[model samples]
Each structure stands twice: as structure tokens, then as C-alpha cells.
Target chain A: MAALRRRVLEVLPDLDPAQVTDGSSLKELGANSVDRADVVTMTMDDLGISVPVREFHDVRDIGSLARLLRGHLG
Target chain B: MTTRSGVAPDGVVVTGLGVVCPTGADVDGFAAALRAGVSGIGLRPATVDGEAPGMRPRLVADLRGFDLPGRLAGLPQLPETTRRAAARVAGRSPLAIQAGVAAAVESWLAAGLHRAELPGERVGIVVAGHNLTGALAERARAGYQASPAHLPGRFALWYLDTDHVGSISQILGITGEGYTVGGASASGNVAIINAARLVAGGELDACLVVGALTALSAMEAQAFHNLGAMAGAAGADGPQQRCRPFDTRREGFVPGEAAGCLVLESAGSAARRGAEPLARVAGYAARLAGTSLPEPDLRGEVGVMTEALRRAELIPAEVDYVNAHGTGSPLGDDVEAAALRAVFGPDRPGPWINSTKALIGHCLCAAGVVEAIAAVVQMRGGFVHANPNLDESIAPDLRLVGRRAEPAEVRVAVSNGFGFGGFNTSVVLTSTTGRGRPSAARR
Candidate 1:
């Protein structure tokens, strides 16, 4: 989880981690479709974790997405 | 309305050109494609099934392989290259700058006009774009999603709303006036015309016009796919099937991304620098058709073209070539053809016509200038290139050149760019020598 947090921070240092906690909504913080796509593609390239395009269709929070990536990696 | 006459009022020349098109990054490659009647459309491998289907809207002049140097690459995330490009042209970085501001400064430098030659107060800037706010929104989202604690780092909103204008002013050090305009694709043309007006009125001796738009994100691409507006990949058919402009089987337009800038100065100033004048901007006019987004009013399109001619004091016969706003969509093609017929009459003889979008794909906000560059090339070359992928004629009286270039004694050319909201713009370009007129009279 800490590794995920650091990776996310490297990608978007301007984001507030507290607001992106496990249950926080990315949409509430202005995470749009373009952003989500960029995050997915950049993360896949950097983290070597392939995120299914469809998963991003409904995933709303950083915590949830981290968990999804962790499940896939495990 | 005080209507002025002659090439002087219409005589704003194109001294220099810079391009970032798919065919070739510079003017030479793009000119070659136009001469050879090449089609840039091909299958896009990245698109998925749920997206729009057909031939993937690829540029007959693909820019995918062209790489900007590492120095220029930083501009998408930072403001450095935009500044450097401007400084390379302007001799100095503008104090505070915007994306479009650097472009304007570069254009002025390309024109060989020095900053000290003209009064800074007499210089102005007009820029156009469709997605300024959208860019900010995307950046803000990226920052927020990465971490909630670094809210201040995602300054997309602040940068877009405030810094855009501030940066431009700071770079140019223009204390006079500046503004942004457009209705989507027509924005660039509209901005050019606005700057021309200020210069003609003597309110400013020089005006810089800039147009730019970024690439569509996956979501925006999907939105266009949902609208059934994108051209899909060519299947078993060859590459020519991808985007058949003015063809009987034409399907739709492909979206592209680009930015361009032009500096307009009075003839006196250009002459002072011994800069050879290119084609002149004779007349410009814009009109709106449908009140809504999807619907296009054909009548409005015809009216605007006719009005542009009227403003230039030119008859239909005077126009030698037309750089069409043909997007390859069925309705768009038919309606634009009908509008041309209405203005030119069904019997009008061979006036060379073509669409640059067929070669480069549609560059959204940058479409106007991209096509404008093509028209200037045609005017200088005295020939109109044929349209590739045009297997059969869609309009009877109109000449749709295919597979071969045709010679033309082009005196006047018109470029049209119609945006989503039925925003239509027609710009007239005339030869520097005033083609048909006597030399002494032209002087």
C-alpha cells in the first residue's frame, strides 16, 4: 500500500492523499474520463501492472484502484 | 459601413509558414502530398470495438512517426518549449506568456519584423480554441486522483482561467488589447479576421493571430465515437477507403491535433523589411446555421460564402480554387456541395477544389490555418492538386480533381472552415500581383 501511495504521488504530486483515502471519491475531486485514462495508461507502463480498461469505467477512488491493482499483481 | 476596395485593404500577405501536420512536419512534405494527390487516411490500430466503426480516421499525411525534439516535448507538461520557440523567433522570451502568445512572437520573427520597429502599443493578439477549459479539467483530475493532499499542485483550473491571458500579455509585453474568439473549428479563421480588422482600421499596425488545440483523450474519443462522427479503420479495402473526401461513398471526418500562428503587418512595415509578400488576405466573413450542435443549416453556409465574396468585391468567376471544409461525412459533403452550387451556380466552369483534411485529417481548431497554408501553396504554384480517394464524383458541375494535378491560373482562392455549432467562416486569398489586373494599376 505504501509503495502504491508513493507511485501515485509520483504521478500526481498535486493530489491530496487524505482526500484520496480508501473510501474517498475521485470524481468528487475532479477526476474526469481523460485523467482516468491517462492514469491507467501511465500506471500500466510504469508499474508493469495491466489495468483492464473496463475496470476504470466504474472505479471511483484511489484506494479502490490500488486494491484492484494489488489483487491483480498478487 | 465604409467598404474599402483594391488589393491594399485585401492585401495582407503570408510572409512565412510553420506547420506541425501529419504528412510532413514542415511545408515541403505537405506540399508534395497536395501535388501528388496522396491520401493520408489509414487503419488506426489502437481503437476498440465499442468505438466508431469504419476506416480508422488516419491522416493520409501521418504525423505519428514525426518526433519533436526533447526540448519541445516538455511543452505538454511545462511552458518551456512554447517559450523557447517564441524566443527563437522573437529574439527574446516574452515577459509573461500563454501557449498561443509564443506562437505569435515566433510568427513575427519569421516575418523578419523587429520588435523595435513597431510601437508595442499598436500590436495586438487574437487567439482561438475549443477546449481551453477541458484541458484544465483533465490536468486537475490527474492531480487529484494521484493524491488528495496535493490539491494545490493541480492548478489546471487556475492556469486555464487566469494564466492563459496573463502569460500571453507577459510574453508580448503588449499593454494594448487582446482577446480570444471562436465557435470550435472556425475559431482560428475568426481570430485572423478580427486581427486583420484591427490592423486595417489603424487601431494597430500589427496583430498576431494564433490557433491551437490538444489531442482528444480516450474519453473524448469515445464521446465522438458515440456520436458516430469518427471514421473507422479501413477493413479489407485499401488505405484509400479510409477517408474518401468528395467521393460518392464518403463516410466521415477524422479528428487531428495541431497549433499554428500568423503575424499580420501593414504593407508598409513588411516592405520596410524587404520581406517578399506572399498571398494577400482579401476578404473574410463568418455565419451561423443551426442553433444546436448536430444540425447544420445549409442555407447559412451558402449565405456566408456569398457574403464573403461580396465583401471582397469579387464575383464567383474570380475565385480560381476553393480549399473546402469537406469533412467526408455524408450530410456535410452534400450540404457543402449544395451551398457551393448555390453560390457558384450550376454552370460555373472549372474552379479547382480540394480538402487538406483528406491529407492531414481535421486538425479541429487548427484546421483553418492548416488549410490556409495549403491554399497559399496552391496560389504560389499555379496548380490545384487532385483529391485522393475520390473514386467517383459526388457533385456534377464541381470539378473534383483525382489522381493527377491540374494547372490553374489562380487569381483568388477561398478557404472555408465550418465548426460544430454551424459556425461558418470563409477567407479569401488573392495573388500578390493581383493576377488579372494591370501591373501599374496594382501598384
Candidate 2:
């Protein structure tokens, strides 16, 4: 979650800090397709892990994205 | 629609200008530095690549302290959407794209497109220069070497030269055609020719021609030094005196990092928006030398100048100024001098000749557009800038400006750009103040 948050903020520095919570979707947080892909790849790189592209289909929001990335650690 | 004093409602005119060079970040600031002949050349500290000493060229007119966010903030008149879009698209891009965006934004606003914009589909864009990614590649390599997955996610897009075209188009909301054009150091002029053709052909009413910043990597910089094409060891007079174009003691060119933009709009398009025309693109010509070697061609140089003047429908004598492609390279300057002699002849004191490279260093890919902006500013300001470092001229008979700025009625101006691999371009610009005739509609 922390890595994802950090990368998200880095991509959209103008995003309201308080609004970047577990409830927000990347789209709700104003990240377009390029920005979203960038955040996912950067977050995965930062964590030294890789989640397959197909597994991301079920990811719905920041919470789900963070959980999916966390599941890759096992 | 109401018309300004010297508006050309049908010709192609330069309605806006922008620059991000070692000289200045904004057009106004850039123009002031030009007239005052401020030298941006300075010695860069030498060091090794994590080991022994290196071979990079020591002298450079670097964009040392550039802060893009700060630059964007300085332009409070920029539209909110533009400011936001700029950050979103280019916030984490490479240095060259950042500089290109800064220049593009200034020109867009200066052209009054921010307030009363044309349809997005009607505005095209052209990014000039090539091999713009060596620096970015050099920087990204270490991270990739450490961990292939550790590279920045956007490195894929960032490494391409077309990023300049993509990012700027997204930020500006330009839906018209866009692409990159390259011609070694003559890249900027080639891009301008493309943009002008689009506007003149009525494919687009306005086009943005950006001179892509050329930031040489250590390898690239060393290559120029090794090739004896860049000034390396400065004499006792120091680095400032090293890049003395057209001077007797000139050695070679000094590489300067710069990005520039000129918004070329049809006079009818500009006049409809009540945009004031800074200068009309009277005529332009670009010719290629067949060889891939870096030799300067006198005949090719003279051909472009003569053709440009002829296209502008002006005789050599009517040209009030020439912004020389004088990069301080020994052979380059010599051939250009011979070309000038051929075009202007001996008897009359021809147009005031000077090299902006003497002040801002050679901006490589950005040279043409940067020098074109310098010409437009000089033509509009009614004065020619001085060659501050030229203590003795190699060609004394030519009317090159000396230590101080000289006041003159500059109406017709010709700016030259020549690149290695045989690209020679000359662009003629006439101030739209009635003294010089505006260009006719497409030929």
C-alpha cells in the first residue's frame, strides 16, 4: 500500500493528499491510463515484485491494487 | 476583423516566440540578452565516470539551474488547463522534453492561442532535431543495469525523440498532425520548413516549430572533442573568448543546451485573433549536401542564401541583416564567409552580419529556431547585436557589428543554419512594418 501510494503521489503530485485513501480508484483520483500504468509498474519495481498483467483485471481500487501487489510477495 | 498597423492577413507570419537556452527562459528575457550580447558560455567542471578523468568537452553553455515548475509558475497568464496538463504530461520527463515544453508553452501563450484558440484540429506541431535521447539513455542505463525491472515505467516513452511531439501535443490539446524532423545541427530549420509548408498549404492554420534541445552525453561530447569539432582547451583569455565566430583566432564551436519555439500562423489566422505579427516568413530554402561527412560546402551555402533571397523576391542588397550559421568552427566560418562574399559581393557594405552562437553558444539542433527568434527580435527591435568577442574579424570587409549594439532599420533579415551530413538552410524574415514586403501566398 505504501509503495503504491508513493508512486501514485509521484505521478500526480497535484492530487489532494487526503483524498488518496483506500476508497479511491486510480480513475477517481484522476490518473489517466498512462499515469495508472506508470504507477503500477513503478510500484511493482519499487517492491521488487511482479504481478501478472492478467491478475490486475480484478483490481477495483487502491485497496484491491495494494492487496493484489501484496499477494505477489508470497 | 480589425487589423494591426502592418498586419499581413494572408501571408505566413511568426506570431510568437519562445526560448529556453543558457541565455534566458522567456522570449523577452532572451531578446534582452541578445541585444546586450550576453555570453552564456562557461567552463564545466571535469570529472570521471566513477573512476579516472573523462574526455567530455569542458566548455559548455549549459542550462545549469533550469527549474521547469518554477518556469511554468512564472507565466501566470498561462491557462489553468495548460498548467495542469503540462505537469501531468511532462512533470517527470527528461531534461530535453521539459525544456521543450517550457518553450512551447511560452510560444503558445505569446501567440494568444491560450485565450482565443483555434480548433485543436487546426493547429499542427513539428519537433526539430535527432539523437536527442543519448543523454536520457545514458542516465537510464545505470538503473537498468542494476535491475532491469527498476527502470522508470515511462522510460519506454521517454527514450524516444517523438516524446517531444507527444507530450507537447497532449499538453496543448493539439489534435492536428505532428512529428519530428532531423538534420544534424540544421534540425531546427528543417522543422521550420515543415511547419511553414503546413501553414502555407492551408493544411493547418497555425503550426508550432520546436527546436529540440540538444544535450550531449559525455560520449557524444567526447566524440566532438576527439573529432576536433568542439572547443576543448581554452587559451589564457578563457572559455568566454573560445567561441568567437568569424574571428581570426576562432578554433571550434561550443555546445550549448537550448530549446526554442516559433508559432508560425497564417496572417489571416493571426489577424482574425488580433494577434500582432512579429515578422513575416518571407522566404526559406533547405538544400542537402550529398556526403555524410561533416565538411562545410561553400557552393551549397551560397545556393541556399541566393535561393532564399530570390524566393523572398528581394535582392542581396535589400537584406538588412544575416544571422550567420557561424558556429566558430574554423572551416565552417571560412566557407560561410566565402558564401557571403559570393552572395553579397565586395563593393557594398552588405546586411549587418553577426552570429548569435557567439553569445549563446552553438545550440546544435536548436540553432535554427533560436537564431530565427534572434533575427525576429533584432528586426523588430530595430538594432543588430554585437560580436562581443570578435577582437579581429576574419572577414573585415563584411559589416559585422562590433563591441556595442548598433541601431539600424532592420526590415529584411536572413538567418542561416547548416548541419553536418549536408543540410544547408536559409530563412528570410521581413518585419511586417511595411518597409519590407510580406511574402506572397503559396508558390
Q: For candidate 2, give the lDDT of residue A67.
A: 89
DockQ of each: 0.03, 0.51
Per TM-score, the best of the predicted structures is 2
In the range B324-419, model 2's lDDT, one tens digit per residue, is 999999999999999999999986778899999988899999999999999998888889998988899999989889978899888889999999
> Cα lDDT of all candidates, in order?
0.64, 0.88
Which CAPRI level is candidate 2? medium
lDDT string, candidate 1, B256-343, tens digits: 6545666676665567657766767777898877576855568887887888878777877677888888888778888888888888
Give the interface RMSD of candidate 1: 12.6
True contacts kept of each: 0.00, 0.35
For model 1, chain A alone compared with the true chain A gives a TM-score of 0.65
**Pairs of residues clashing in candidate 2:** B9-B268
